[model samples]
Target chain A: MKEENVIEAEELTKAFGDFKAVNAISFEVKKGEIFGFLGANGAGKTTAIKMLIGISKPSSGQATVAGFDVYTQRESIKKNIGYMSQKFALYDDLTVKENITFFGGIYGLSRAKIKEKREQLISELGLEDISNKLVGSLPLGWKQKLSFSVSLLHDPKIVFLDEPTGGVDPITRRQFWEMIYKAADRGTTIFVTTHYMDEAEYCDRVSIMVEGKIEALDTPKKLKEQFKVDSMNDVFLKLARE
Target chain B: MSITLNHISKSYKKLKAVQDISFNVEPGELFGLIGPDGAGKTTIFRIITTLLIPDAGTASVAGFDVIKDYQAIRNTVGYMPGRFSLYQDLTVEENLTFFATIFGTTIAENYDLIEDIYVQIEPFKDRRAGKLSGGMKQKLALCCALIHKPKVLFLDEPTSGVDPVSRKEFWEMLKRLQQKGITILVSTPYMDEAALCDRIALIQDGKILEIDAPEAIVNKFPKKIYNVGADNMYKLIRTLQGYEHLYSVFPFGEFVHYTDKRDSFEAADLKSYLKNAGLTDISIEATQPNIEDAFMELAK
Candidate 1:
């Protein structure tokens, strides 16, 4: 069964005053595929995600996520998609359980569902011992994983993660990707951004952004072959140089 | 100039940030301090640069005592802090000029040292340092540090939060600076970056784990390594972990990196083990260990 794409964008553009953060980028992510959005810092990856998730409006072009128009159906799109920002974004002063409950409530999950999801997320992330601990006290890896779990508490149709593994240990990053794979296996489209070239190889497909545009987009294997490079790192170096 | 740290330990209240760390950095060597966050890399850098004095132990840079000859040490070493501690309100050019003035030198005096990096960001020279991009901020901070032509350069995670391209560029710049025979001491959390150094000291939990060349560190892994892959990889890892001879099993991208408990166990045995476990399309191959692998083994 060839399911329809979970995300589609055409000539998407976003301008902040005179700067075009995301310029004329177009890509599609099929349902259940892990799509990697890659770029250098300040290379428009975050801006594109912001538009696709309906948090930032695109100045031009058309986009649809989870079958909802990004411009007209912002509410519907928000309800069906999850986003984890570059910054941890969770309230540091809140307890682990409180953060979970707060995010669940914001997503409009009922009180019963919030309680159920909170318990499940805590147990899955092995945060039970620290559930009562303040979020500030948790390690960076733990905070990242917990933030990811909370993002998926409502079982959105798709999830967007912006550099989710930045500054995390390789082992922790490995574990986090495992969670992403599990989610994708359950038919959730995964959209993620990362600076680690090796991590790009994990995606089913990846789009490399330079300046404000998508310079290259393909499966990691195809990109490596196209660039005639042995590793993703070499492929990135080749493309970034151009 | 060479650096020596003898029984260097620093503490704050009840917490020990660094504990009795002793090491020597030879002249013209690119020494890297590799570790996770809060691993005392920053504290050690501060102590060595004379910004913070250790409660005990002694440190000397270029034969000058770090505490007693603080001014001399500061003048002889260039430091790029972990947090990009520079004057954000000033423009890139202004920051460079101000730092050079503090050291009683002009940017023109050492223009050749940072010319390559400066030229790339010269167009944005008028932009405020705070408004510059992550990579640009890194370059500006570096130029400011090197303007004084210090004998030793210290970079504390200079590539953090930067794009991969910028990271490559920054390292290239460091290599050039090293070519001028400047002793370099850099700290990074990235194991991959550790490979670029002439020698590296792996730190964890505020303690030294291992200190050696990256290649030597990788060669020290005691177990036979293998990279295994197949469809249903998660199930494969679980099954491999159950095998009697498995030393460690961890996911490495699309494949699982594993080591055998017994030297007698061969690659064929691993393949057959997966085959017998009802796994299909399995491929197993012996693999070379990397710096991260060595660090993981040592961390355990």
Candidate 2:
């Protein structure tokens, strides 16, 4: 049985002047699948993510996110996907409850639904005591978790996380992964980029981009065996070293 | 120049950024302060660089007190903060020149010190610092920091989000600089990079957990860790966490690093526990703990 793909790309390319930041990359993310996008520091991950998220226009090629065309239906695509990044996720000045309600409103949720979600999120994340506190007052770990929960307030078909757990404590990082796992279990497609190679192992399949090209794409186990490496870190080291 | 911290402590209001943190770095040695963000790595860096004075205790960089001899210490050390502190509007060459000029030196005088790193970004010298890419900006930052060519270097999170390739190359450059008799104190959130340091201080929650060589740190891990794998990664973790004798269950690459609460733990017994949970394709093997495993255990 072929799994339904929520994300499809055919030679998606993005260029700047003479540099092809994302060069003709093509891949598909199956529904509910956790896809790991790996690359070097200067590799075209940010560019590729922009193209996939319907923000920046691709220089060439074709792609669709959640059944919406990248070229003509970017607005539709935006409405069907959730985005969260470590750099920017939630408003610092807003209280936790306010942030949730605000994001729910932005996602076009009704008042009743937003109220229900706000309560559920607060209790689920064990933030009852701090729900009324400003998001900026919370610890980095808590803010990160709150933002992740808020990103799903509208229940987008897919969630694109850009290094969501970077610099978080190890325990909290694991907790965040548990959240990702639960989300994937509920059939939410997760497309994530991370520098932590170990997190790359948790994905259903990972694609490593080098110099704006997808060099490898496979399950973590297969990639390890194919490269004769014990861990994803070594596989990355071998590929990225060159 | 050596670095010594004698019970150095600092706090920002209620947060104890660094509490009684003490460590020593030999001359020309590469030392790493490994921890997560908000773990007081930056505070410690700031204290050593003479940018922030300690609330209590004392710190000496290159035989000069951080407070009493701030100017002498500043002149004796090169510091690259975690954030991009260079003038964004200035061209790369102009930024480099500006840094050199402020230190009462010319780029030509210390061109040899930053030659290897500066050469990489030299092609983009004419471009504005803000317009450069992430990797290029890092190179330019290093160039500006090294223009003064001090005895000691303080680098904060030099390779936190940097990829494996650039991180490797950056460490290589650091190793070369260390060879030239410059003590280097660098911090990173990446645990793997800890292995590259001569010695490392594992820190968290404003305190030092352990301080030793990377290999030695791993050797001192009190518990034996197992690389446990199964068909479903999430279920495996959930089941393992539910085990009665669970000490720690961290999600490592492709496998979970499982430790038992009891010293007399058996793999067969755990395998049967997982099997009862309907977990198939179970593979359990004893593995040598790395710096990360050591860190998670230490911080836990």
Candidate 3:
């Protein structure tokens, strides 16, 4: 059986005047796979992600995400994907349940469905007692979990998470990965970006972006073996220094 | 001791920000306070630098009492906070000169101290600090912090949002600074960075869990850990979590970190069990514990 490619990009190029933020990159993401996009601070990882998510048009390239054309069918692409950016995009002043309800409404979920999901999310995170508490009062870990759950409210075909576990504790980070695993098990594709090399190991496969080009892409083990590095951090250092 | 703390505790209203934590740093040593956000690492830094008054206990930097000799301590220590605090609208050169002037020193007077880092950002001297990239901003802030050449330096979460290459460069700069005989106390949420420190104190919830060299800390994890993987990682984690003898099962990078409560355990037994459970491509191997594994054990 052949695996489906949920995302496909060929010769993807995004240029800002003479500077190429993303230069002729090409890759495919298998359906239900967790694909890691790794890079340094200004390495154009964000630019590539924006193009795939249909927010930013590529200067020259051809791509399809969830079977929708990136150049023309962006509105359809937007409907089939969920995104959790680095900044927690939740309303801090709103109560937990209210925030969930508001986001669910934006996704056009039914009123009854939103109510059910709100309860399920609150209980799943062990927040049953404080469902009415303002999101600002919750701990950082709890807020992060809530933000992730809300991103999944509409159950889009794919989820794009940008540094979802930054500044979180080990325990919380561990638990967050567990959630990601469960979601993947249920057949949702995950596309994530992170600075933590350790987290890179969790992905099914990872691609290293250096200075707007794909430097390496393979299973973590293969990349480590090919680079002859013990860890992903060392592999990253070796490539990024070039 | 370059830095000392005795039963330091701080509370904001009812929440205990720091709880009776104590540690010491030797002169010219590179020490790390490793933990996540809200772990009370910053509170300790602020307390030692004489920026905040602890509700109880005493601290000193460079032999000066934190409470009584705050002015002297301030003159002898440099602090780079987690967030960038430079004048964003000003040019890089202007910001550097302003910070140097306030510290009663000129950039030319301390040229040697910041020469390595300043040279990297010198081309952008005329660019506004706000317009600089993340790595460039970090370098500028570091240079300004060292302009006066303080004996001890405190950096809070310096590499949190930085990229791999820049992070490597920053650590290299820290090594050069340490070689110059300046005591450094750095706090980071990254466990791998702990190995670069001479010694580290693992902090959580405003308390020190353990303090030792990075290798020593990893050696302290008593349980045997195995790196386990299968064709279906999601199913692998779920199945392993249900295993009766498991002590902990969490997803690591490529493998699931598995530990059993019972000391009497064998890989063959678990391997056959997974095979029977309809899992293929199983790879299980005993692995040495790392600082993060040790931290999870200590934090428990």
| Of candidates 3 and 2, the better by DockQ | 3
lDDT of 3 by residue, B1-300 (tens): 999999999998878999998899999999999998889999998999899999999999999999999999988898999999999999999999998999999999989999999999999999999999989999999998899999999999999978778888899999999999899999999888999999999999899999999999998899999999898877898888778889998777778899998988889989988998899999999998899999999999
By DockQ, rank the candidates, best first. Answer: 3, 2, 1
Give chain A TM for each model in order: 0.94, 0.98, 0.97
Query: What local lDDT does model 1 show for residue B278?
Result: 91
Worst 10 residues of 3 chain B by lDDT: B160-169
DockQ, per model, reads: 0.53, 0.72, 0.75
Pick out the ten consecutive residues of candidate 3 chain A with the lowest summed lDDT: A82-91
Model 2 C-alpha lDDT per residue in residues B133-204, reported as the tens digit of each score: 888888899888889989999999988788877888899999999998888999998888899999999999
Candidate 2 docking class: medium
Candidate 2 lDDT tens digits, A73-177: 999989999999999978999999999989999999999999999999999999999988999878788988988999898889999999998899877888899
Report the C-alpha lDDT of model 1 over A154-204, residue by residue, as the tens digit: 899899998888777667777888888888888888998887777788888
Stretches of candidate 1 above 4 Å error? A16-19, B276-279
Candidate 3 segments exceeding 4 Å error: none
Greater lDDT among 1 and 3 belongs to 3
